[model samples]
Target chain A: MTNQSSWFETAVADLVDPQDQRVWSIIVSLFGDMAQEPGAQISGGALTQIIEPMGIKPEAIRVALHRLRKDGWIESDRIGRVSRHVLSEFGRTQSAAVTPRIYARDSAPVEHWHLLIAEDGTGTQVLEDVMLSDDYIPIGRNIAMRAGAAPLQAEGLLALDISPQTAPKWIQDRLCPPELRASCRALLTAVQNAAKTHPEEWTPTPLQSATLRTLLVHRWRRVVLRQPDLPAAFYPPDWVGPACRNSIIRMLDLLPRPSAAILSGSG
Target chain B: MTNQSSWFETAVADLVDPQDQRVWSIIVSLFGDMAQEPGAQISGGALTQIIEPMGIKPEAIRVALHRLRKDGWIESDRIGRVSRHVLSEFGRTQSAAVTPRIYARDSAPVEHWHLLIAEDGTGTQVLEDVMLSDDYIPIGRNIAMRAGAAPLQAEGLLALDISPQTAPKWIQDRLCPPELRASCRALLTAVQNAAKTHPEEWTPTPLQSATLRTLLVHRWRRVVLRQPDLPAAFYPPDWVGPACRNSIIRMLDLLPRPSAAILSGSG
Candidate 1:
């Protein structure tokens, strides 16, 4: 392999998450990033070409596809001898739900925030229901917060629309845990380093671009989706969420989104 | 008794709190209302003359005075044949703390209010401490609210400075229970009825004026002090707090505070 090709391989190794390698999740990220638009489809060969170089075997990709099909997240079709996959209606809805937050360059710093507090023990289930269905972040056993001016319809809970003043250590820790902070910091560092070493004059071929984009979107999806979208006050003192987000956006901008034609090798 | 004297007697009976006639607490209310100034004293005979018409025997008055002395609330002085009682410094301090709220002609609406929520179960103790020391009204097991913009220095508790938008039934009931509302409504009705029948031209003797003042203060104190001082939203829909306060103030205005010299029989 040429030096440039070796650098590309090393970059992929550095970018992919070491802790989570669920192939099904990786394929979901792939579809969410590239083929989320209606009628967008990826040929079977193109899917292998994009994901296999991340050290996943073709059989692993097939198994992940089988699982995705079984879960009703993707539908498969055959034209002549080539099989292609498209996001199912369920998959499209799920992807659309988070697409704005994941792809937003700058989220409109959640203007209005409210809190919901349950009674100590018996109200635990009520607060849990609000947290799960209403996008509330639980700050304590009986306390949860969400971004909105409108009060939640929690019957036994006290709701307060608040402008957050000071977030202490425990609240910061609860909202952004140590592990999440570390993951964000790790991603920021990797993306920054990759950007630094990337050659300025080089133009990647379609296959090369596909490989890089897959790795970038896969890692970013893990970090971005895991983060609680909140105002700056909610993050820990040393959280690198903003830096990681900026770095992820800058890196994705560098690797322009390849058209399905280019990714399918028909350009 | 003449017609006017009979009217005075009936008015005194109507004004005294039917539920609570604790003589010691009545004396506290008298001192807090008419003699809160430092060096203020009430002659023992005058104290009896004022409270005796509330149907409490002089021996009961002596027993209540004994209890008050034992509780560090009052001190006694004797010079030859006359005895006098004065609120102890501790008693004065305790009485002064709630006097303004109890006697104010109009309570300035609580503009800023805040809620503090502790973690369920384990955090009950923290919230309890805040409620005991601060002016927090406990609305739920883990939730308490207080008036002010100042954030409480309660660690591990989620504090939100909220301008109440809406308060539901449970919170309203928690802050102003049925018993409190009934007490307020009863006081309002009694004071309104007394105000209607009071003879404007009748000039009361100093002792009669003292008796009227003591009865009004005693009943009003029971209602006012029992209330959790919170914003209007916290009260029940049928709450008569404002009406009771208005009636009490009007009644108290009619029964002007007698001079200490009159109360001491030395005017």
Candidate 2:
């Protein structure tokens, strides 16, 4: 909260790249919480409730879960209609080891992101950002805000930082092992790049490259104009040209500044 | 474009406050090149081409516009089947004036906000916040890169800046007067706050002083959570609580960062 602008900057940075690391983050968070509550099967509403604050749509969650299952990292161990993540033995070992790709912690997973979907109880799909960051803080707190989770949910982002609210049970029991954070970071960044290059496209195993990021940036520029805050001139060099500049600038001058926050984990 | 988090924050803000002003920001941007076209009238695909990037759910836009027309500020001057802004005496006054609310544009206007009805577009619907920062940068450019009226489009935001791009006559022509800017700031803030407090229940004139800002923040909080970089715990004090903290925080922690920048805008 204190270092908001910088925090905001990084949070936004994750968005500029392509990939779907954030979706994994949501999945990890889901499993983590599920692991903690004994006899507690994470219900449909519970998942929906948690994601409400985050911009992530419900549809995205289902897709991510399916993708995770396909990747062999997670499986469904269902008791009736309720769902529980069944991490494969390999998944468990990796959760402890921290693969250089997506970090898989069974507890205290981040679900700070949420999006509104026009789907069923599972919720509609949200943006699936699968990029990884080189740092855990970036992976944890920054992107969490983008999902709309409250500030409290994002505190876990800093490994060595003191959490005013997180309890001993959650932290001590759920830590993903700091060593594996690096691999997760790399994985996050890679997936992020891939998603950007293909906005309408989806791929669980993305290359996560710079080429993808440029395309994402281009996409964002388009977003600004459609938003109509300014004219073509205000838009980044990539999105506009002279003939139209005449009418666009008038709109840019009209918008006001914006503020946002994200909360996760049962809120 | 470089500041995606900020841009998204703005979008989140608008979504949260889907009142006339914020909603108009969403819609006018949807108007796309048409809104920026000075005298041009907008139609179907053109609207979609411009709007999809802004992420304005077409449904939301319809709801808001329907409500705006019911209120008053907007009425249509029918050239044919599709109506154009009669550009009311109020419309012309608003559109031509340095600032739109040249008269008593305050609580009274807000009270009458709902008066702007959807009746055949016969009257000028006071466009609260039509046009976005991004609207004119590209389409009207005839697809030109450097030569389109990019400068015109970027106006106050770009043209008047220290390093002005090549000036666009149109951009310069549309510059909002200084006084109007101040009024806009205040009006926008008031409208923004009201929209936040009132979400789906929004109207041009919300009787509840509880203000729409409250719900707007909550709804937007939903979107904020989607980012992977942000942790679930990283939310503002207003949103954190027994409600969303845990799930959001845990989820964010599990996600990856530097995901894809799926959408963006001047906001």
Candidate 3:
């Protein structure tokens, strides 16, 4: 490979998440970023060209595609001599649900927050139910929080409308675990490093841009989706979520979304 | 006894707490109200004159005095034919602690309140310690609240400085139990009834005034001390604490505290 190709490959490796490289999840991120539009399809060769450089084997990609098809996330079609893949309706819906949060330049500010406390023995199970269905963030064993006003009907729990003023160390650690903080910090450094050194005059073809976008999105999705969208006070003091978010958005803007025809027809 | 004596005696019986008349506790209230000043004393004859109108027998008073002395709450002096009683230093300190809460005509509005939540098992002990030492009021098994800003140091608890916007039924009921609400209502009605029927022109000697004051203070202490002083949101819809407090203070104003000189010298 040329020096230019090797430089791009090194950047992709540095940008990808060091902890998690689940082939199926990477594929979901790829499809979510590239072909999430209705009826959009990427040729099989283009998918391979985008993901193969991330040190993923074609056999692994095949296995992931098989799983995605079996799970109704992707559908495949053969036209002439080339095979094409597209996200199924279920996959598209799933991607649409989180795409806004993952890709938005700014996270929506959660205005009102409330706490629900369960009783010691029997009421914990009820609180578990609310946490599952509602967007409740579990801060402790018996306490759950959600963004919005207190629920009108809290049958067995003490629901309090609260605006947090101070969060002690234990609460901060519980909400933002050490591992999550590390992940965010690592991603922020990696993206900031990539942004700092990239050549200003470099304009790559659609396939190159697609490959970079996939790695960036894949790494960010793993980190961003693990934690809930909570108030800033919920994060640990050393947390780098805001910086990571800014870097991710800025990098994605640098590498604009490539069209399916350009991605498939070139290689 | 004359008809006038019988009338006053019946009125005293009507005003006293029907649920409880623990003699030792009543004596404590009497000492706290009339003789809490350093070096103040109630002579034996005057004590009997003040409390016997509540229909307690002389032997019961002796037994209560025995218990109080044994418990280090009262010290007695025998000179010639009369015994005198004064609160011990420890008893004075204890009485001084809650006297302000009970006797204040106006309840201070709790402007800022916060909730401290402990972890399910281990942190609960720490929270219990804070509750015992601080002014924390337990609202649940692992939760405690107090007035003012959140503490600067909450090691293992989720300390949320909050201004309560709405309190549900369970919280109100938990903080103000049904029995307490009932007690306050009963006191409010009893005090109002006594005030309504009191003759405008009747005048009493120091012994009669002390008897009425002791009984009123005794009954009010039972009801007021059993419940925590909390914000209005914590009270039940029908709670009559404010009204009860008003009536008790008004009636106490009507029946002034008799001087120790008059109490000991008259009888």
CA-RMSD of model 3: 2.7
lDDT of 1 by residue, B66-149 (tens): 999999999998888788888899999999998788888887557588878676677789889878887788767777877887
Model 3, residue pairs in steric clash: none
Sort by DockQ, top down from the best:
3, 1, 2
Model 2 bad stretches (over 4 Å)? A1-22, A29-41, A99-267, B1-267
Q: Is the docking of candidate 1 incorrect, acceptable, medium or high quality?
A: acceptable
For every model in order, what is the number of clashing pairs?
A: 0, 195, 0
Candidate 1 residue runs with Cα over 4 Å from true position: A119-132, A152-156, A265-267
Q: Which candidate is the best by lDDT?
A: 3
Model 3 spans with C-alpha error above 4 angstroms: A106-112, A264-267, B1-4, B108-111
TM-score versus the correct structure, for each prediction: 0.94, 0.17, 0.91
Per-candidate local distance difference test: 0.79, 0.30, 0.81
Query: What are the DockQ scores of the candidates, in order?
Result: 0.47, 0.01, 0.49
Q: Regarding TM-score, does 1 or 3 come out ahead?
A: 1
Worst 10 residues of 2 chain A by lDDT: A255-264
Which scores greater on DockQ, model 1 or model 2?
Answer: 1
Candidate 1's residue-wise lDDT over A141-174, tens digit each?
7777888774645587777788776665667777
DockQ of 3: 0.49
